[model samples]
Target: MRKPAFHRADERRFLDERGSSGPLAPNGLNPATIMEKAVRERIVDSYFYKEQCFGVNEADIVDRVVEHVDFIGGVTGTVQKPTPFLCLAFKLLQLAPGDDVVDEYLRHGGDRFKYLRALAVFYVRLTRPDRDVYARLEPFLEDRRKLRRKGKSGTSLTYMDEFVDDLLTKDRVCSTSLWKMRRRDILEDLEILEPRVSPLGTLEDLLEEEEEEEAMQNGDDANGQGHDGDSDSVRSVSRSRSETRPRSRSKSRSRSGSERERSNHDRMDVDEPGTQRSRGGRSP
Candidate 1:
């Protein structure tokens, strides 16, 4: 049978259950074009892609990903054996799992089956809209669960949060080229996304606490105590820097001027003795 130029032979809808269409590449790039052509070809030709990745529907694919995927990686070794994670990622591109399936994958393992979650987010990044990608992936920034990732160099430790972050910020991850995503701040400005709240809270608050502690160490007796008593002994020390910054600047400027004058006076005193000694020698 003559195969159509656009679709691959292996890629006819395996079962009526799955509607296999090319990735809904937001930019209209076909699914085959989503991955680099060479990499896509490699994945298609690889033993895993041929054997395991074939004929899987949305439901089966999920099982395959969770049960089979151990280490998250791209191609590893000199022969470039594709990781099961990458193979499944490519499988997702082919099956084109719907939003709900993707969500199921994201929420599926919770902490138990993390690589599945990793694969889901990877697929999401490849397929979803810019705003949705940021909104969905940013929450995982706090996941912090450890992930094992393998590569040409060998396996290394990574975290779920770090992987999610790389998906958002990096141009390439796990050897797959990521589509350019809009900046998070840009989306927030457009009101497409809300600003993400960090788990540790704003950095400014931590700096303020540290500054208060340092100031208290320098002079607790002067600042006095507050409601917390001992804990708030540094309370007065925590006054907004803006209020006292100008006064400190003025004091520093005056001190520098006085030091300069004292240096000049000392120089004059030393020169007077030298001048007297030279004058007596000339008179003799």
Candidate 2:
């Protein structure tokens, strides 16, 4: 018998593909490594093209980074170990104008001034820090009416802020109804970001309301009707006070998902950095 045509073709083809006459690892490349390389390339192209003046649009940059932001926010039980890409993304978003994300960021731990200033300096080349974008933001500064307050910390306007604020304002007005209402959904994924609106009352407000409730409770107790007092009445009083007291706007909670609605946002820093495990606290 003679060796037939195309005999051992599979073996030869495999060697040809590898550019070697030997076997190699079946998977060929590590996914994590590939992802890392890809992210690095994109960042260099997007943010570090020194010669390319005024490169990527700030709005576009923020949109691209939103995924990383969400990833950083969702990782619980750990002090989110963000990759360099994630860190860069965070830096970009911070520099990007738009209070939508910044407002949410303020809810997280730490002083907002430091983070905001750091990002502003990195992108805008400002000599000092400015807490409020509304003041020196390029587009807003041009429009005298929108210049609500002076720039904070003596920082000047940056192109990044101008781009972001414009994007946000435009999205609110010209974009579809969906985009206008989509901030809460986008913000939900971030761990540090919270509803900008506050659900709690001020110390004074709480005290006053509590006093009122106590008075009502005392009257009922004296009449021997404390136990028999209508549950609705008690709820009504508390709820009324809660409603009337000036509150920082709370983010709207979605009731459609029963499971999510029932879940609390609080975390005990379980397995987190900057925190020690303690027996006194309830389970995370």
Candidate 3:
């Protein structure tokens, strides 16, 4: 009988091609044991686990990720039932898909179906070696798409980047304890990993650049209006004042001088009474 490609021929084969399995039973102690016992138990007991997740192959898992998986979480409901998302995660661990299939899952992370990519990310964090995990997951830090995450703390909004970061740095995620990962700097120091380059670069530098651009733009706007518009208005105001002020001042001085001259002419016309009498006597 020909078996499917994802089904490993080695002893590591946990599920046959038909995906036959007993409830809560795993073939070995590697990945199935990686998840906590309580979480594994809840997942196996879940109705979604019994109904939807049963007999799912690697291809079927993708369909489930696209259709059924919405929120990333370990358990939901007040009674603490395992979520369908968690059930599929356990299913992947149980089936142990090959690296190529996992890569295919990651390749679809470009906004059409982000939840599926998240599923692949969680699986990679758990299964892959620490170095591979960092190398695989670090590239996706630039993915800032929003995601809905459900947990014991209730549902909340989270970003794709934030979720991947949690898987790397946080001790526990989705109600499962994550293995401690080496610090990124330490790995870079040992020459194990290249230094991480931030996608947005330094946030402070970006803000400063934006502020400078706005300032330059405002300066340009001021110049645009002031040079052609306000400058002429200001000059006209100054010119009108200069032309009218001295003319009024000169007119006032001339009127004052004429008044003084009129006073002197009246004084000359009205001779003194003694002078008039002397002239009359001399004529006699």
Candidate 4:
């Protein structure tokens, strides 16, 4: 007969038996034990599930996993888990892209180290290490190697290369800190001086460059010669007095009361009973 699944298969079996929902452990271990198991298993199943179910699209899942790992890894001070855990979580994430229900069960205080390690591996893979993100991450490798050198008590690096390569090909749901002294040493070796914007250019140059781009696009449209046969109806109407009426047209239609009074007076003088005014405004 096949041996039982690792951890609390019997308790899991019991939970299945009672059909009761409660705070169940991955095996029979309590929270601390669970964390310990993460170190050994090299994976964090629940975290993986939670990430896969976060309602992200397939294309976005890897990025989301990388982001989550970064956020958590930064908190944990390192991203290194047991190889077994990493491998399993990686496989599960790849398999569960269509299942969007994992988020419902997410809880705080889970295993941080496992997920953090997963995230770093996932990030290295997602960015493919050929771009700027990889360049930024190169600084972290010494810390990583040291962590691995600490033996199983620390993080695992054996499968890192494999994990990274797999991340490049897999649509996987996935998922450090250290002190300044060692960080400084690593930085010195990597030649990563603090970022500096050189005297070669200024913010004004950037703005001018943007303006030039926009002007060039507009000029391209204006200089194009293929539309000469197109109708000029809009321009024709705008330029024609018959088609373009002044805003005062309605005012003229309903002449203001003062102007109306003036007109009435002038008409009355012309049509008076005993006097006649010539069209030139003189009485005749």
Q: Model 1, residue 12: what's the lDDT?
A: 31
TM-score of each: 0.68, 0.24, 0.70, 0.20
Off by over 4 Å in 4: 1-37, 41-193, 196-207, 225-284
| Candidate no. 3 TM-score | 0.70
Candidate 2 per-residue lDDT, tens place, 30-74, comes to 112212333323333443222221233444444333332211111
Query: Mind giving the per-residue lDDT tens digits that candidate 1 earns over 1-284?
Result: 99766644464342222335433455444555677756766787788777887667878876787678888989899987788898888877777777777788788555567888899889889988898788778888888888999999999999999999899989998888888878988888999887777878788988998999988876765555333586654666666666699999999999999999999999877757778889989995
Determine which window of 10 residues in candidate 2 has minimal summed lDDT.
172-181
What tens-digit string does per-residue lDDT give for candidate 4 at 1-284? Answer: 99886533222232233224334222222222222234423343345534443334444544444444322221122455323234333333333322122221111211234344444344333322233323434333332211222222443444433433333334432331111122333544676544424344678898999999999988888766435424466567667866447656766766787688999899977666444444446635
| Model 4 residue 8 CA deviation in Å | 28
lDDT of 3 by residue, 198-217 (tens): 87677788999999999999
Task: By lDDT, rank the candidates, best first.
Answer: 3, 1, 4, 2
Pairs that collide, model 3:
none
Output the better candidate (3/4) by lDDT.
Answer: 3
The TM-score of predicted model 1 comes to 0.68
CA lDDT of every candidate = 0.78, 0.34, 0.80, 0.38
Of the two candidates 2 and 3, the one with more favorable TM-score, higher being better, is 3
Score candidate 1 by lDDT. Answer: 0.78
Off by over 4 Å in 1: 1-23, 219-284
Residue 244 lDDT, candidate 3, scale 0-100: 100
